[model samples]
Target chain A: MKPLTTEEIRAVIAAGKLRDNLFKATGVFCLALALIVIVALVADMVIKGSDRFTLDFFLNFASRRATQAGILSAWVGSLLVMLVTAMAAVPLGVAAGLYLEEYAKRNWLTNLIEINITNLAAVPSIVYGLLALGIFVYQFGLGQSILSAGLTLALLILPIIIVATREAIRAIPAMIREGSMAVGATRWQTCRYHIVPYAMPGILTGVIIGLARAIGETAPIITIGALTFIAFLPPAPLSTLGDGSTAGLFDWVMAPFTVMPIQIFNWTSRPDPAFEVNAAAAGFVLMAMVLSMNAVAIFLRYKMRKNIKW
Target chain B: MQIHDNPTLKAEARNLNFFYGEAKALKNINMPIYDKKVTALIGPSGCGKSTYLRSFNRMHDLYPGNRYEGEIRFFPDNTNLLAAEVDPIEVRMRIGMVFQKPNPFPKSIFENVAYGLRVRGENNKRVLDDKVEHALKGAAIWDEVKDRLADLASNLSGGQQQRLCIARALATDPELLLFDEPTSALDPIATGAIEELIHELKKRVTILIVTHNMQQAARVSDYTAYMFLGEMVEFGKTDEIFIKPKDKRTEDYITGRMG
Candidate 1:
């Protein structure tokens, strides 16, 4: 084989540049297309729903008349469901991730668990709803309550949080672990002092993003039979204390719940065009909440990476 | 100091054999570490000097599937360190290690130095502050880092980080210290500084070091052990090992005739 001449080399370099530029342009174009669609949708929602985007809209309950409908119950329900999901998922997922990464030996059983967890992440969200319906709603006899809905969503996002936690834990270099171990720290102590703190930002980011996804999830909660219409707020944990009600803090967990997405779904399904506007407003609110959560996670990750050096 | 006919042994390895799954990483080995003295293990790469150093504290326990066949006995108690009943964590507390790379935790300098004490549940601020300062001074880094104790350890220079790790290890008041090519990642000046620190540290703690640099082994060690192919070929006074080695392999290695 002969080596390339200067002209041939130049031609090859030019061709490489051309191919690189073509790929870059193609990627940019696809990204721009997606961005355009998202902008168009958000803009349409804003224009259509701007009239209803008011303090009153947030304060009013669902009404028979679309013009008077508000998302007070839906937003509150969304907040409650997310609270349950975060509380249930974060610790459970992190513990499972820690066990898998730090303690579990490389064996058939661990490998099997790892594979199934990854597979579970890809299973459709609605399937989780069915599982929750079967277990929490029927077998456990918890019925279609906030507890059932929260548990179902927790299951839905469990795989995501676990995967993220593992990734975050894995990002820490082995040298840190060795450093801690060399100093005579026990396994649990090393994990608590060195590994977990170093990986906290990553873990929190994962949990927040998981929570964001859970906030927007409608199918699974709907499948678990979350009500689309609930005029009265789910009794707050302390709401009954000073309100002369018989309900206790424990009642809220088993009480019926309605989330924002379900409320949006219900409004959009109505025949009235005004109800469509209401749906758009509610959808905008949900989008804002999810995007803000993701933004906060991104900001935290940036700060953590900036402050921490290996 | 008056010399005794028999030196007090800090730790002793008896016919030690180590295996990494099916492949043997070390053969039968016997060596004694003297109290308050420095022993340097010298050999080329893959000669198992680092492996032998780690065996003393069982650093290899962090990984699975690695096995040890013989005992390394701790003095005073005569505990077989290689035995399953012996806890590696406890062994490590008394025998601290400085790795080839300066791996200070990503934390404040004070926190890094106090980590050992903190692990043992010493939460009193007064105790931690006093001990942390003492350790930093012991490692000869207090003069440089005294004012910046709250700064991130990672912000320090390579030599400073290594010294901070030394301080962290020393804060526990260990009986022995292991240096596995502790200066390999540093510049010549930093290496010289670490060598000086090692020389001073032997006054209070037993020291064992492994180094590929023959000059470094000769310069800093009181006794030298020459290893080749996972076996110790010669062990004697540093002067004798470097100048008058009896074994042909040791002679060849010291003379740069073979690696």
Candidate 2:
């Protein structure tokens, strides 16, 4: 059939090879582009912020006296708020996740709930800020306190935790359930003893990732009316956000609190040259916290994959 | 011609009918699983042989839209399997099973066998160590994998994995071992090894195996039950079932005259 000219055959082969080549190259190109973008972003964040990384930046709270100020209060505030959020949100989110993925009956209500959760996950952090402002501050009388802000952040990130938990649960094979049942294990035992242990790493990874997102958030805490300029190192303890006064519940409701995002926002906007360096250093510290959480997540993921059996 | 009752005819089914929604899967299954004797169920694919076997422990209970309209009873000394108060979990503990695929829990080899012992609440390390070794030896895989006890079971070969599953089931020290096409997923060499193990196993425990391999049914089982279209067509001594089956259908199946 190819008794024709060599050049023509060569041309035809080249065209076919090029088409096949392009088909395979498309996926590779997409992957390469993704890697390049990630590298570029990390490089940019590091260059812009890391040079100014300092200990004093983490020790002293923001001061009106620009040249001497650091992100101490904001750092402490962010850590406190996130810890509280993690404490409040993780258990509830994971429990809800377990119920939905493992125990929920396949009914209309569950379907509705699942759909709403997905939509909630898509809701902008800005909307959560508005939610914090209206219900938490005004209606519930929580005001702009760290407690109110933490509740807002918890609500914002709970959907992510649930979704991640569900995925982790789903990754467990049906055979494990069957095998457990066949060996006289109760349904609860199958879940609690066999299933949950297997799903732990994935769920942990999800929580760490969700926390990273929560810590990096700015707009929602802003809407909660977190103060940008709080000279005090949180009043309650190593972790209190505002004045730490739940004053008679109602008076307590009408108090002001500040968080890391507000401090970052406040620092980033100041009209001073030295304050900008503190902002970058604070940014660096913020990046470290998020990256460390991510590292824990990555380690958990590796352990999970290594330990997972067929 | 003779169906002798060994004292352990502890588990018995009388006119049991299993239906999957609208489709009848097991029709009037009247079988007696004798104590301490291997009774193998052999049939072609889709013959409801596994269905009859699964009915013994009600393994299909978890599946939706499947119903049984007849009785499966256990002995008084053994407790009634069909009793309303009877827990399927307890029944499962009594009648442990191994599947066609080698399903090792994503655990260490030692942990896999020890899983049943642990579930049964035998936590003593010495006891676990002994039981693990005993069960492994019983399945004829102990010598091969005895050293790699702490390694992941997924690292084992197909045959070794299947043997490990058998060892795991055996660790519970169940009265009956239900093997659902156990060797179907194995190579010829592995299949032979498992068959030899089964021959050795029937000496102590009741082994009920389901297989499409007619030769295997003839080779391993002391008593063989032939099934087709959800019905137990004929059952007798393995030699008689293969050589001189009373029913024309059984003879047809054995002689390759029919499926």
Candidate 3:
């Protein structure tokens, strides 16, 4: 075939540029659409709940009067349940991930385990609640308390943390491992000195993402029998009780709890329109909590990754 | 084997064979590594030069299903390095390695060199400082990094990083050191610096190096072994091998008629 003239070449180039511009426009439009929807939802919540943004709104307990209804118990329970979830999941997930990546042999058994773990991440969160209800609440007889709800959320996020850990570990170059081993260091030495530190940023990101997801998990929390009208907070770990007796350090974990999402769900289902305002305010608060967790994840990742390079 | 000037044997491979999960990579081979001398293995890609070099420290044991037959006998103790009961970690403790690319840990320069000693449970600060300094000086990179040992190792240039890796290997005072094309990723000036460092290093430690460059073998090694398709084609004094190779394949490879 004969070569094309300069004009024909220019025409072809123009067509390709047009297509590229069209694709760029399409991507920008899609991004803008998502951003607009999120912004609108946040704006609506803020405007509807503007009257209830006082300091008293955060300090009061659930009352029959809408003006007196507050999220004191709801926020505290959410915080405590998240504390349990993080404590339970981080160690178990990180250890399992480290073992799978650095120690386990490549065989059919390992392959089966890997596949099952991936599948577990996609399983419904409510299923974990049901399992916790059977094992933690009934069989283990922990009661429908903060411990059961926390344990349920931990189960729901375990797969996320594990998968994240594996990916973070895998990102480290093989040469680094080989370099450490060549210096007469054993397997455990290599992991402790190099692998764990290098992969810390990625692991932190995964942990925060998992916690963010668990914070808004209403289905699992409700299924595990969280109360919707709790007036008192879980017992302070070392504070004096109303009857003047000292509370146990671990007493808070066993107290019946109500989280932010459960309170919102209860308010939205009420007959009075005033309760709807409470739901909007609580929803915004939950969104802020999740966003702040994500921000912390991003900051930690940046700080940790500052020194590492390929 | 041809006669030499009665060099001391630091280690020897006796009927050594290696297999990567059923496919034989190194055939039966026997070669002696002389104490305090540099030995270079020269071959084309996929010719098992690296496989042979890695066997000295049992680097292959890190992966599953890679099997070793016969023995790599270590000197002074006559330990069979490839034996089932012999820990690869113990073998590696006496032998160190540098890879093709510079791989400094994401840590302070001092910590990078202090790592091997730390693994051996050396925790005293003064002892670590002296050893790390000596290693950096031995690798010929002390003056440039003396003030910034606290800085991250990854901040250095590629050549500096490579020399830091050498210091890392040298901090433990191994009996033998392995270089797997350590300067292949470097510029000509950096390569020359590494070659000079290797000449100085041979006074204290036995060295085994694998190289794709023929001229590198001629410049740095006292003895040379030519490998092709997992077999030792020739082994002799470096001058003899470069000037007049014994095997037809070795001659062809040296003359650039074949790979």
Candidate with maximal lDDT:
3
lDDT of 1 by residue, B204-229 (tens): 99999999999999889888999999
Q: Report lDDT (Cα) of residue A306, candidate 3.
A: 95
Candidate 2 per-residue C-alpha lDDT over B1-259 given as tens digits, one digit per residue, 9 for 90 to 100: 2345444675677888889989999999887777667788987789999988887777887666678867777664656676557778888988889887888888899998998877788899999999999999999999899888999999999999999999989988888889999988899999999999888887778888999898898888878899999999987778888877899988888889887
Ranking by TM-score: 3, 1, 2
User: Candidate 1 - CAPRI tier?
Assistant: high
Query: Fnat of each prediction?
Result: 0.75, 0.65, 0.82
lDDT of 2 by residue, A1-310 (tens): 6486999889999999999999889989999999999778666656666655667656776778765677776777787778768887898888899888777777789999999999999999999999888998899887677678778889988998999889988988877777777777777777777777888888888788788889988898877778878776545423434566443523322345566666767877888766766666666678778888888779877877797877
DockQ of all candidate complexes: 0.81, 0.62, 0.86
Lowest lDDT 10-mer window, candidate 2 chain B?
A: B1-10
| DockQ, computed on Cα atoms, for candidate 2 | 0.62
TM per candidate comes to 0.96, 0.86, 0.98
Report the Cα lDDT for residue A236, model 1: 67
TM-score for chain A in each prediction: 0.93, 0.81, 0.98
Evaluated with DockQ, which candidate comes out highest? 3
Instruction: List per-prediction Cα lDDT, in the order shown.
Output: 0.90, 0.81, 0.94
| DockQ of candidate 1 compared with the true complex | 0.81
Model 3 / residue A241 / CA error / Å = 0.9
Better of 1 and 3 by TM-score: 3
